[model samples]
Target: MTFFRAFCIERSAPATREALCGRFLSLDETALDAGDVLIRVECSSVNFKDALAATGRGKVVRRFPCVGGIDLAGTVLRSAAPRFAPGEKVIATGYELGVAHHGGYAERALLPGGWLLPLPASLSSQESMAIGTAGLTAAMAITRMEENGLKPERGPVLVTGASGGVGTLAIDMLAGRGYEVVALTAKAEQADWLRGLGASRVMLRSELPLDAFKPLDKGIWAGVIDNLGGATLAWALSTSKPTGVVASIGLAADSHLSASMMPFVLRGVSLLGIDSVYAGFSVRERAWARLAADLRPRHLASIMRIIPFEALPQVFGEFIAARATGRTVVQIARSGETEDMT
Candidate 1:
């Protein structure tokens, strides 16, 4: 049995609900809920969901006093499962973590063995967290596009919200795989960064007129990875080439889509909904393997901002406010040493 320091939220007074505070507390191994594996959490990353959960918004937490982090990477300390063993580095994301269960905010975590994947040989623990759920989702989007016949010989591919983690990685991976990548972002200042990540072209979100609800428009892109749904998705659907596909991974803008279905019926456009939470293990493994292989972006480390655990709350606020860019990783343990928090 071992004990470690962890962050805990304490709601002192009912009137001070807005002032709910987080403090470091000493936690014992026995405090962890039942699971087949015990991991020492070395690093965790902030996603939009994590930010929402940390800020007490979006109904992200179903229960109080929960450790809030949806993605974590570390080393296995102990495992009763046949597939993993002690001293192996691993990653855990999605599947009720950080929401219905205590998650990666702690220095240690206990998780069902089925929820963990062996850390890919091509990625370090830090790199894995840097990729996190965003990178994984990006890879899944590309895989879906390819599965839906998004060929390199086809015309250009468009990535909406290209300044974000998923969008940036999608651009890098798509371009890396020999497709002409068009980055769509609201941040004009990040154009150089997006170009550096292999985007062939960059367009501002303001340039796209979403209010025009035309049945169909000029067929521009061969395919699209749309992280911002709502108007962007509707616009993408309306403007996509014949037989083009759009993988809808997020609703950062809004969930509702007010558009005609003529594109779907006439142009053979397919809108695929993507969810990381319920992805099958085979699909998860394939995505991670591809991320380790061709989809691994060369500029991944450059886009990441590393901060200590103490700074998680403030950084999360910035993420929720749309002020944070690229990927933000929380360093929970000493450098280079994998912490098992299972």
Candidate 2:
């Protein structure tokens, strides 16, 4: 019967254009949505989507007074679900979290039994939050690419927006899989850091421009994991080698793609849309398994910044401005300790 503090956004009027005023409030367990498992949230990571939801910029928040964190890693405090028990470690991301449902910004969370995944043996709760939804999206993109015949022997793989969380993880995971990875970043200062994260080469976004609406360009990449979805994705599609697959994960840029169909019709290129939120449980389990095994980033800790929960508002602003790099994890509870739910 313990109460906790949480951040909430309340919108008074529903208009096509509206503003959200967020504040910290006290909440009890009864305030959380009904669920079979109660988790004492240890860490919750900040993602670009979380930023959008927090700011009310991109229709990410469907309801008022909602908590906004898409990814949470914690210890189970109580569970009616047979798969999970008290003291078990778990992580939850995607599947309507931080959107239509109340999310993980609080010290506590009540999530559906099926939405919870047992923490992988190799990852700690902090490490899992560091990976978060951004890392999972990267893993899903890589898994999709591999399933579509991407191989280390083919040629170089390109990761667009390579300094962001998903982009950084994609670079690390692809390089870990033995692919020669080329990182494309808008920030020139992060070139050395990207290189240290196993990137074979780093290029500025200005260096790779889509000057013309050409149907196709010189074939360079064996595959591409594109987080920037505007002209950058269009250029990747036009320039990828024949039979190459391009996985579109995020839309940091504009979502609309204005390009010719000649790349697909003439070059046999494939554009794969990656939606991590609605992915099936089996698929998510396999993705997490792969992340625990082959896809875990070697220098994962280097890219993570741990912050207190109170700093989330400012962090959200930085994320929305595209200034924050790597993973921003919010520490809600002490490490290796389970809360009493009973």
Candidate 3:
């Protein structure tokens, strides 16, 4: 039996007040959850949800002792599913990964083939992981908005949580497509960086009068990609132009929405719920196709940082504290070992 390293999230012994604890463990194939495709995980990336799950900060993990990564890119070592073959380069994100299933924090992963997609040829495994769940959500938001008649010429698009992964990637993608992007962030220091990511302007979160959300404010944004929920989302809806689109991707701040329907009823504003997890195969495919093409972030190198797999345990707090920016890719396999499974 071969042994491999995995980061597992498990229940703390009954005496401990904390409900969950995460740790590194050595395990064999027998320890992994049952699935059709076996992969040698080359790379994985940290997402806000992954941080919440690993740290017991949010109700994210559904199964105890599950591996702790939501996104992975790898080469298939074996596959019983007819849709996949051994040696194929693939990527998997969302679904039950890192929540209810053994996930990508391990050197090896066993997952249903339905959860995987052939990695885009233009992207390396590290690149795919850098994009990960955040990039996928951003792409879905853009594609959905475009399909619903959003155009670059309509008006500026506002991306909340602008220093985070989804916001940074969305700014790059929107700018690449010739849209004027206004980034909303609490970090004033990141203004120049956000602008370099193609944002035309940076609006500090503190600058927005979130406490004073009006039923209908002067229409400003033609579209809004909101990562933070609660008051920021309400503000986005209240100030959107007629026929505007708002894609809600995350609830990092708060989940509750206390807003008026004046924007929807009078301005005809559309609020789209972007659910990356459990999105249908067709939706995932379409999003990835766009990601590989026009929707790919132009500032990927500037937006991503690579860390060794062993360092994963120490980094979750950065996310929990909202101190991390852009993307952090975990290098799982040793250099030059991703394709050489021997």
Which candidate comes out best when scored by TM-score?
3
For candidate 2, write residues 144-222 as lDDT tens digits: 8889999999999999999999988888998888999999999999999999998999989987766774678888999
Tell me the TM-score of each prediction against the true structure: 0.94, 0.95, 0.96
Better of 1 and 2 by lDDT: 2
Which run of 10 residues does model 3 get worst, by summed lDDT? 11-20
Candidate 3: stretches off by over 4 Å? 13-20, 338-342
Task: Please give the CA lDDT of all the candidate structures.
Answer: 0.85, 0.86, 0.91
- When superposed on Cα atoms, how far off is each prediction in RMSD? 2.5, 2.3, 2.1
State the lDDT of candidate 1 residue by residue for 228-267, as single tens digits: 8888999999999999999999999998988788999999
Q: By lDDT, highest first, what's the ranking?
A: 3, 2, 1
lDDT of 2: 0.86
